[model samples]
Target: MFSKTCEYAIRGVIFIAQKTADGSRIGIKEVAAGIDSPEHFIAKILQELSRKGIIQSQKGPTGGFYLDAQSRKHTLADIVHVIDGDQIFTGCGLGLKQCSETKPCPLHNEFKKIRDAISKLLRSTHLGEFSEQLEHKLVFLKR
Candidate 1:
């Protein structure tokens, strides 16, 4: 699973992508409300994302967050990398620091399979796909 910040960032980014796929801008309030995240938490996440160039933002009137065509092409893996690093894809499932192939934890082998599957899903899923799924009501970012 993703960290709380990672989860919110993914949700916020997808909402922005859905709203701004046509090169428009979406406010943080709208993104947070759309994904049911707290405004302050999402705002901080967005700020970090903007700082990292994972998403773009502007200040003042008629300014907010927007993802250009190239940005929309980035995968969920990219966002995960920016916010959470490669730990989720590389770390032990049971939080074992010394777990590895040779000195495997009890759940290491099985967890590795699941982890790889999740990694592939993230790597293959892009911002546009995130938007499209929401646009079609095939998935929900909120409860």
Candidate 2:
């Protein structure tokens, strides 16, 4: 599972993609509202994303967040890496510091399988695809 911050980042990116696809730029306030995240927290997340080049940002009256062509093609994993690093894919389950293949945790094998599946899901899912889902009202970024 993703952290709360990661969850908001994913939702914020997808929401921005949806709006950008419709030729709109979204500010932190709009992105936060769209994804039902706290405005201040979402602002930091969005700034991190922009710094990581996952999403585009501008400054000025018309300045806001928008996805470029490359940004539209970004996968969930990309955003995850920016916000949460590779812990979800590389860290041990059950919070074991030394757990590994040789020194397996109790739930290591099962958790590895689950983690691999989640990784694959993130790598294969593009922002644009989620944007489409949101645009069509088939799925919502916010709970």
Candidate 3:
């Protein structure tokens, strides 16, 4: 499971990715409304992403958040790291600080394999590809 901040970050990223070519910048209020997330919280996540160069923002009448070309190269892992930090993925699922193969926790081996696979997938998957997959799923749902 992901944190609320992580969920917000993903929604914000997907929203930006969907509106990328609109030329009309999307404000935090609009993004929050569209994603059903808190405005302030989403704003904070956007700011973090912007500060980390994962997303871009402008301050003016037409100012808002948007993703630049470079943002396309970013993966879910990058967003998660920006919002939640890398420790979330690296830590043991059972909260064991010393979890390892030899010194395994109750579900260490199984959880570690799942966690490692997820981490790898997130690290290697780009936002563009993620958006495409999401779009496909949405289409399937509609059908």
**TM-score leader:** 2
TM agreement with the true structure for every prediction: 0.94, 0.94, 0.86
Residue runs of model 2 more than 4 Å from their true location after superposition = none
lDDT tens digits, residue span 42-133, model 1: 99999998898888998889899999878888899999999999999999988989999999999999999999999999999888876677
lDDT of each: 0.90, 0.90, 0.79
TM-score of 3: 0.86
Candidate 1, lDDT over the whole model = 0.90
| Residue pairs whose backbone atoms clash in candidate 3 | none
Error of 1 at 95 (Å): 1.2
Q: How displaced is residue 130 in candidate 2, in Å?
A: 1.5
Residue 126, candidate 1: alpha-carbon lDDT: 84
Tens-digit lDDT track of model 3 for 77-136: 999887778766678888878987879899887887888898998899776564556555
Candidate 3 wrongly placed segments (more than 4 Å):
130-143
Q: When superposed on Cα atoms, how far off is each prediction in RMSD?
A: 1.2, 1.1, 3.0
Worst ten in a row by lDDT for model 1: 126-135
Q: Which stretches of candidate 1 lie over 4 Å from their true place?
A: none
